[model samples]
Target: MADPVILVDRPAAHVARLLINRPDKRNAIDHAVRQQMAAALSALAGDPDIRALVLGGVAGVFSAGGDLPSMKGLDEAGARARMAHIHGLCRQIAEASLAIVSAVEGIGAGGAIGLALLGDEIVVGEGTRILFPFLRLGLTPDWGQLLTLPRRVGLPAARRLLIGGGPVDGAEAFRIGLADEVTADGQVMTRAIERASALAQLPRDALLRMNRRLEMPSATLSDELAREADDQARCLTGAEFNEGYEAFLARRTPDFSHL
Candidate 1:
């Protein structure tokens, strides 16, 4: 069999670390990776010995985004199906009893940005980059990003990111509430492990209940995810998305003036 796309490491009895293993592809989330991750997360959630989970990428990169190559010939229906899979993954993370933490090193762009925000606590390296480039791709945010973004940085800041298409460094990430802590470059994973260990020592039942309660006031995650899928499906079939996707492949700026 081929190597697994997601690696699970149990450094401590109560802590489980899930590492995105496609380093050569910048850990882009593709269909296979998504499936593997879902399986791993499910198993971890069912493990009574695990109380906290850390999500990160191999090497210094978190993830680039969805695999564009895998998306080349998708239609509106195909796009919706693909996004729904990602939404399911997000739902799994949100409902898991374990305290989730994200350890970001290099960058988390597009869909990866949404994935990182799923963490209850996020630790980033000083040089880490965070970006939301949905507009540039002529697509709306998916993976429940629309809900999570505002929850992390408030409405104003989230608007700037989704509209401006610029990248934010770790310092800004922390200041703007996107990150819980920042450490020296190359030390993100270590710091994340430490944080996870601390979370593991907390009263498990109380912590799990508190996490669920915190999510109660927000719009239901499932409904928001469905809305995102609808919007993304429409955008995927539009002319603007064609131009944007083509420009990305050609490494040129997308011209959306006509659209």
Candidate 2:
């Protein structure tokens, strides 16, 4: 049997690592890879043991995006199906409550950029290239990137990057707020996994609640005050908070492993 295109590994307790295993193809996401990715993410989402995820790629390369060769010779229906398939994958990542970190070493292109941006935090190497070549191909950006990009880089920068813009290297990406952190090529994956592990140390339910609020920020101060009231009420009454309070007085790190 062939090796899986997406390799799932448990690098740490409560943390899963997904390695895109297509170095010869520059980690291009073909249809098969998309399907596999969706399934893997869904499984991880359902796995109560997993609290966070780190997405990396083989050969120090992230992904070259959709494989153009595999994308050719598609009828209208086939094309739509392809888009819908990838959309499902993108939706899975976007809606996931698990803290996700993406390690971009070489390049993150096209649809892959959308996937990378879906991460709660992105770690890019100094030589990493972030590409958005939608216009060059005469296609509007897909994979929910139109929404994710703006959420990451704000409207003006997102607009500029998406419309007739060239690729942005790691430095430019960091300057534009596209990347949460930047590291040397050799350290990108380590940084990403470390970030995910750190997030995993917190209470999972709290992260889910926070993700809910972030997904829908309040438009007014009163609304935000009500939201915070709801958040604090739920948290303060939880066992995690009880332990945390006791730990604060005891001057020790709270052990949230059981929670």
Candidate 3:
């Protein structure tokens, strides 16, 4: 069956809106959601007319990262597999040619935070909650969060989030360089599009080149590439990853079998 976690719409000439549609779960990532997000990104990569994309979640939520229930019963192998796929999506967004703008309202956590950080420009709503709850759960980071967050917000700040459970608000996110702009509630998506529309007007080739520069890993390129592969394999085997996938298929919470 087709993945149902994402909803896509193109309302403007060169702008595409890809909304995370699983509000009931706070737009948490499951296997289905991950597949849909990757597919949507792949489709956008080939659409020449689409110059910019806006990613957000329905209601007030952005995403809470992986569904906890899915992590409940995963073995080490299952967790590693899940991590690999999540990291792949993060890399795909980073390498995509078209500009991406993230409109974050509330709750950007775990892999969800990685997705938002992939944006060339991120616009966040005032008072929105952004956190990285990985260390809190005794899980190593995945989804390019380990690799990208420190680059964008600095290592010290990244550690603060990764190690200390956070519910960082929008203003602080901007102060720490996590957000490009902070808009009033309900205005994030519109503001993000306005910026994206301007970006869409630029020459495509120039924009793409700039995107590549901004996304290039400052770390040794080979190291980053290897790290991506390594992290993915580890995540795939984790018991949490398996549990999460099973819960998603069964439509229930994960049983935390790996722990």
Candidate 4:
């Protein structure tokens, strides 16, 4: 098989490094890329040998977010399906038993920003740029951007980034609590792996449960959890989901149904 668009490796016995490999595209995610990301994550979800995950981009770029070309062909149903898929992946990262760290070195935007926010810890390179430019394209935030961003940086900061349509550097990212550490150039991923490897040595189950508890909502916990599961189940059975999954494995853009 050809190399996966998302590369996964077990650098340490208990820690897996998952890297988005399409640097040329600035790691922009298309249907296939998103699917592969989900697949790579699912592969490690419950593996006994894996205790943590480090998610990063290539040498510098984290991701520029969703691929506009791939998105252009999507119809209403297709758009709904695409949102569902992206949401599912975000939820997975949110719920992983293994700790996840996002190592961002260059730029992250749109849904890619959502991915980074899923991490328990976010490490950015000194030169990294973070942007939320969805409104520029007349698109509402998808991929949990609506959910995670506000919580990470608070409503006012989130509004500033989303409505301002500009990039924030690593320092600002740290100031906003979006990034845990700012590392030297080319060291974000390495540092993330080291951190994850150390975390992997802890009691895995306890750590995982802690993450779950941390992610749990303070209000309507039972209601929200049930709703999340219900929506996910409905989304999984949609035609757009099927088409997107097949296109992803085939390394091509998805041809989504009308509904």
Best by lDDT: 2
Better of 3 and 4 by lDDT: 3
On a 0 to 100 scale, what is the lDDT of residue 37 in model 3?
A: 82
Cα-based TM-score, every candidate: 0.81, 0.93, 0.80, 0.80
Over 62-116, each residue of candidate 1 has an lDDT whose tens digit, in order, gives: 8988887898889999988998899899888887778888988898888887887
- lDDT head-to-head 2 vs 4, winner: 2
Tens-digit lDDT track of model 3 for 1-259: 6446899998577889888889889999888887888999899888877888888888878888888998888898998888788878877888787778888887788878888787788888887888888887888877777777898889999898888768888998899998999989789888888988776765554446445545665378887667567655665675556766888899986543123
Candidate 2 vs candidate 4: the TM-score winner is 2
Best by TM-score, which number?
Answer: 2
Residue-wise C-alpha lDDT for candidate 4, range 37-119, written one tens digit per residue = 88888888757778778887775788998888888877899988888888788778887877788888788888888888887
Stretches of candidate 3 off by over 4 Å are 1-3, 217-259
lDDT of 1: 0.83
Cα lDDT for residue 42, candidate 4: 83
The best-first sequence of candidates by lDDT reads 2, 1, 3, 4
Q: What does the lDDT read for residue 231 in candidate 4?
A: 53
- 228: Cα error in model 3, Å: 26
Q: Give the TM-score of candidate 1.
A: 0.81
* Worst-scoring 10-residue span by lDDT in model 1: 203-212
lDDT of 2 by residue, 1-259 (tens): 9889999999888999998999899999998788888889889988888889999898899999889888789999999988888878877987886889999889899988888887788999899988898899878898888888898889989999988556788888898899999888789998898999899888777777888788778999999999999998999999889889999999998877667
